[model samples]
Target: MEISGIGSFLRNRRFGNYLEASFGVNFASPSKVAVKEEVEKKIQSVAFVEDDGIGAVLISWVRIVVCFVTMMFTTFIWALIMLVLFPWPYQRIRQGNIYGHLTGRLLMWILGNPIKIEGSECADEKVIYICNHASPIDIFLIMWLTPTGTVGVAKKEIIWYPLFGQLYFLANHLRIDRSNPSAAIQSMKEAAHTILKNNLSLIIFPEGTRSKSGRLLPFKKGFVHVALQTRRPIVPVVFTGTHRAWRKGSLHVRPAPLNVKYLPPIRTDDWTADKIEDYVKMVHDVYVKNLPESQRPMH
Candidate 1:
């Protein structure tokens, strides 16, 4: 599980503090769940399925091309499937899980990086999965790892992203209007209701945006409120290597080992109004402790 020379390299650029503070949990080396499946010869779809990129430049561009084209095709198919599954809300979301998993799995395979997931994936639990937001790939990777159907709380602007946005809406994820304080609050309540009624795990990135510096950003209180209101356990999912793999402000999807570890679930039964801030820092610390040494939160 050790990555050679990455520590010193990050320190040289002063990004060392970021890795350690990112995840506060100590997850033992759990069984490695390899994301790469057996590569089969498929001549039918060579245009989008080729994995023959050699140099990093070629490899990265290949990923970008394939990702764009494959997403278009898959999203269209998913939209159609979702339309048919519309009568059963839960069934539609469950199918969205499989569709997203397949898309993410394809991206992982094409990126040609090994992914290691630690801890158990929760299924059939109405819990909330909170994690640090580092890169765009983080969300897609989360979709690949989480055990059950997960509804996310994202910014309302995401609804404008063409076909993918339609797919997102069809999946039953909640959206918050970040600019409107009251609307955002109402969105949180709606999210809680969705969790309870649908019996699905919720995924939220409390930082509100991607970390441009790969450091842990200060969390907003919205997700904390949702977890408290819903009385759902909060599972902190920590990720390493994604910020470097694709990084912020970068377009290339370079090959790098992506690691995901789910920390112990925090019980909200004891997290009353008076202790909300304390629990926030506690959960944040668990994420920081589990993060790599260099990425730890600055003192």
Candidate 2:
């Protein structure tokens, strides 16, 4: 399919040249643009069921049943494996990656959603990932895109979940107490220390919670504080179409094309706590400008 609308605008050579000249931002190459176009074509070809008919309703119900069954079965198996490898932290983390990949593939297969990843490739080096939140599926999308040894930072409430919460704890992700400032600060310190000592990458959703309106929300400063403490490069990631696939507060899943794009990383060698809001606004603007008009916030 031909590139149009926001995609065309982003890939335009003149716009890229202007960005490079004005802000020193490097635009995607022609080869990358071609790849994106092909991916878009593939996404467009996927069959999506319209929710207006009884047949569609039945299909959606069946899909939910299959997804729930698959998730429960996978979580049980994953928990067993974690139990077996609990004695070794590094081994558990490595095995978690394998289980994570399998679960991600299984969930996507059941939903009939194809994930298209674009932009900067993830390397083995340690860094901080800041991403826009839209749906619960964002975690799975991130897992499928990132390499092994990357841990996520989640709220303390997630620990109260049943089987999934146990697995998350066993997976060794960082959990922060959002209700208490001192505890949250301590969690960030421990998270930074874990990243440095274990040589692992961390993913943080700066918005803190999923966006109900499918638009990027104002970012919280927790992620910025973590980046500053760790002195790591911040990689910004954006997710499109996930909210439509499995929307917030919705029980049904739909077939939708999901895209995960990784932007250039921002180095924090000379950043200070006083400049945190400015940096957050800068990254927020990147999402506002790059997201398609349909997905952009209605102001």
Most accurate candidate by TM-score: 2
Model 2 quality (TM-score): 0.82
lDDT of 1 by residue, 160-234 (tens): 988767888887667888887788888888878888887777888888988886778777778788877888988
Q: How far in Å is the alpha carbon of 208 misplaced in model 2?
A: 0.7
Q: What is the lDDT of residue 51 in candidate 1?
A: 36
RMSD of each: 11.9, 9.9
What TM-score, computed on C-alpha atoms, does each candidate reach? 0.78, 0.82
Error of 2 at 283 (Å): 1.6
Collision count of model 1:
22
Estimate, for each residue in 19-86, the C-alpha lDDT of model 2 and write its tens digit.
34433334455685664565566556766554746676677678878877887898899889888888
Query: Backbone clashes in each candidate structure, one number apiece?
Result: 22, 0
TM-score of 1: 0.78
